[model samples]
Target: MSESLATDTAKPLNGRLAPPRTARVVGLGHRLPDRVVPNGPIAERIGVDADWIVRRTGIRERRYAAPDERTSELATAAARRALQDARLKPADIDLVLVATMTPDELTPNTAPLVAEALGIGAGAYDVGSACTGWLAALSIGASQIETGRADAVLVIGAEILSRVIDPGDKRTAMIFGDGAGAVVLSADGEGSIGPIVLASDGGMGDAIIASHEDRIIHMDGHTTFNKAVKVLVESTQQACERAGVTLDDIDLFVYHQANGRILRSVGEKLELGDERVADYVAETGNTSAASLPLTLSLLREDGRLRPGQRLVLAAVGAGFTWGAGVVEWGLK
Candidate 1:
């Protein structure tokens, strides 16, 4: 009946079901290529004004690819930064998980190629779940550490959507960007890791999806906006409940940076204050699975998140998929 009990009600659901384990984050980093495409230039291409875009989506600028950059380049840069933060060499990694909708090469999978580039050997592969890709990767890494299958896992969210965007259509050209973010997941025995909840409804798969069939971002903006807000709120509540923390108890909350309006809707649902959530949609635009981690990198740079802080990672996109997880930050 009380708010505190209601706040963490979902955590016990996962706790009574799964055995205890230990997990923690050791490092974090991100990278974006050196191209800034502002709304005014995009408006000229799409026959819309900067004012119209701002009024509708609240995006000012987004990064794009250089003539030479690709998805692999972005991911590798972010991964290197993450490894540097951890103060370890590439060979120290036991596993690498790349969360991406756009793979550099369709055959061997992007992970192995990334491993080869970063010199991590054959202990790498790829995971695809559209915008929810990173959260899915985080969940998989958590399980590996909890079960002792891996001592350290490199989780990355990277995208080079500009290459796939239809330059002729301003609708998408204005909405997408290119970037990557990485984090090292491991165990600390202090219960730094907690419950995670993931959900899906394939029927809305078209709402915000890009197909490799034609390799284009096809989105029903209104539908995607509505669904993202609803699902993220549900998962956020579920994650908080499972983590034994109330929304108010969380030090910071991070969500997929699709749009400023969408972020506001989710914030309203959880009664979260502006200080609790960070917004980068204005700068990075929507980098698919890369959005949240990139936002985390920016926040951490300014010294926002710290030990003993509860973090909520939430996202909804493509495959009509959605997920939320609560990670307790306290790594030495």
Candidate 2:
């Protein structure tokens, strides 16, 4: 159950601190509760329709947490899978980072529980940056490795929005789901962690927050969307520059899965086109922090992502948080 695993991708790259020849993405995994909430059923239950939900948010279906499933448990499940995929034991992990606003207890920290379950005895903590949680974790994890404080880190985005999603609120119930996705990041002892950019606009936090109603989700979609587009474009540009790459030179884009409209808006502003941005809201709904990393893993499995492609990983979510990262696929 060690944390560091035998990876098919980890290999000796270029200079240690300089431009890394590569940073292999060792493992990837995800977990979703057993309950399936089809669009029609959800719509019927909410007095809405399939077309109605799709037209508004592009969410066709989503998964809900089992009544007994805790947020930490779901995260642990995903971490175990990722460890297995990387052929790593829990003890091998040097750090553990959990991204969630729907934490199990909000104390003792979800990261420690996940590490305890995985057998990793490294620094552990939870990040509560709303939808931007996972992407922020990626940046933080990369930094730890880049600085040598930790060579390997487990970054997970897990959510059980049902804990806060008002089932009666047709606007949100149709758009949120429960799921978790995790990845293993290591330093460039063999590769490098490049230009990563993260930004925040606390002013917009009120646009899509779940506070007043005991922290239940309450969002202003139009306002949130407008800000998302602008932040996404700016983040992408800044990260690309830091990575020493041009915007036009980038290949694929993995963005937070909130809405198809949001994705289209970013692409239009940046001229990235349909091939550039990967949006999964149509299939998975808005999984909050888990959306971007989940899609990245899927792309890897489907062979839709080729090695050496410059990837822009970005997110804009609650707290009005946003960030962009430039990653050249770490491959053999």
Candidate 3:
């Protein structure tokens, strides 16, 4: 049969189905605390040299929220910047989703507080997947647009981890920071968002978990490192296949800023050059849910990202949660 005839036969009997609408990130913003804590103090408190902290985590300085700064406050600030970046007001948003594990208060969810502060009269909620929270929320927001549940949604990942980490615990004291990052997603005339893959291994959750007794973050560094590289590589490859693309087609790689060593290892295994991979851990230690989006925002601010570029985002969080997705940058 002729190629044209075969193409014509593939259409539905009634008519050709319209392509599904998709959510595209139209704006991005991030906010880090003004107070920057160098590794000196943290190392001293943990009875280690500053060089030891850097050699292990590749973190030189990290931000700590002020006494009055709460998770909600950081989230609100980031949201406002996102709205401004998209040239839209809070009233224009149809929904708000905050991806966070650290809430300002346990009684009230932080999303609603963020929405109220933004003066958005829309549905608001929270999603917790630890460091993978933002990617999970991105997938959810895209699905909402595809399903006609929302036209424009604001997604924020904010964390005030300073309040949660046990300062005396050397394992975590120098490895966490406080920050918030946000993106505005809305339906577009042309689809920009692509396939997303989310997975979890609850059985291995204990590898990276916070102790309930002491509320301190404990991680089997060696075990978690291996898992992170393997899962991240797998997830990214799956997303690329689902998006009908290849690894070489990707313009940039944005992975969760968990550890510098993990990032380098993943890049090496993927055979990707250093310039193709992003490294933000040196300036901001793992911010949990906020890491991915914060890194993205920084890229945008530095004029590193460009329109029509293909980006692959992957992340691994506590609970063994991990996700990857493809995005075609829609910004001008």
Candidate 4:
């Protein structure tokens, strides 16, 4: 996380510098389960009315994975779509990175399963940064490409938060959903992805946690809301500065879809109009790590994303982890 406007570079052991390389996003894909869970049922279970849920979180409905579906399945589906969008085959990928907090099992990791399902023999791993997992994984994948370690990498953010949220807990129950999203990064295009700024504060880890005893998510809403806004704003600014651009130069601001009120507060603080800030939380709820990429896919479907547009991405998650990055849209 250098505070400089330069592509990440690496040096060889012979005391020579490798030519600077850049990773560009060549494809995007996302998947949402068929079952739509509206706020009405969730509100009833939490002793609140549907309108109260809407006013508090601005989430009208959310998708839930079926009992037979697992995180790996969702990830594999999204990865296939991304591969198709990139016009790439399984063998084209050199590495696979899945950002997930809710994995299928406690032993075997999710990425390897996804790779096997996709018929890709590429090296695979998982990044577990909760909601900020996608941006963290994106930074890692881009670094691999920039350092000449891989030509193409598939980065995914998937979560089945419904499995972790306690149905009786209003704080966590009303705020989570299930889905997966993915992107293909390759060294084939111009340097479309810019510098990423990542940081964390472990002391605040208690703000959002799922204890092993109960295996249910619990959150201190007030603490998370205040800290999330502060960190998101700061990180976004830092990412822009490192990219040698200002907020005005960014075509869109895609913060983590944690809550609608938090998004609005961030926008008001940044003096950005509604047109500039994205608000997909109303429909997606909080998809945790899947929020960023899923929102990007939706934006593309709605024709809001353009090839030359510049966008800023930011997120703050459970570990009190946070990251932000700039992207010069290059997808065709």
> Which number leads on TM-score?
4
Clash counts for the predictions, in order: 5, 16, 0, 0
Give the TM-score of each candidate.
0.92, 0.89, 0.93, 0.94
Q: What Cα-based lDDT does every candidate model obtain?
A: 0.81, 0.78, 0.86, 0.89
lDDT: worst 10-residue window of model 3: 1-10
Misplaced by over 4 Å in model 1 are 1-20, 189-191
Error of 2 at 253 (Å): 0.4
lDDT of 4 by residue, 56-160 (tens): 888999999999999999999999999999999999999999999999998598999999999999899999999999999999999898878999999999999
Query: Between the candidate structures 3 and 4, which one is better when assessed by TM-score?
Result: 4
lDDT of 1: 0.81
The TM-score of predicted model 3 comes to 0.93
> Which residues of candidate 4, in runs, are more than 4 Å off?
1-19
lDDT of 3 by residue, 7-81 (tens): 111233123332256578888899999999999999999999999998998899999999999999999999999
Ranking by lDDT: 4, 3, 1, 2
- What tens-digit string does per-residue lDDT give for candidate 1 at 176-279? 89999998876642325666788889877767666669878878887888888999999999888776667777778899998888898889887889889878
lDDT of 2 by residue, 1-332 (tens): 11121122434322223422233467678887888787897788899779988888877888888888988898999888887877777877898999998888748889999988777778899998988999888878876765567767899999988778777787688888889999887643222345567878787777887664487898887788888889898998888766656777777889998887888888998987797788777877888988877787778777877656667888988888988877766542
* RMSD of candidate 3 to true structure, Å: 4.6
Give the residue spans of candidate 2 off by over 4 A: 1-24, 188-192
Cα RMSDs, all models: 3.5, 5.4, 4.6, 3.7
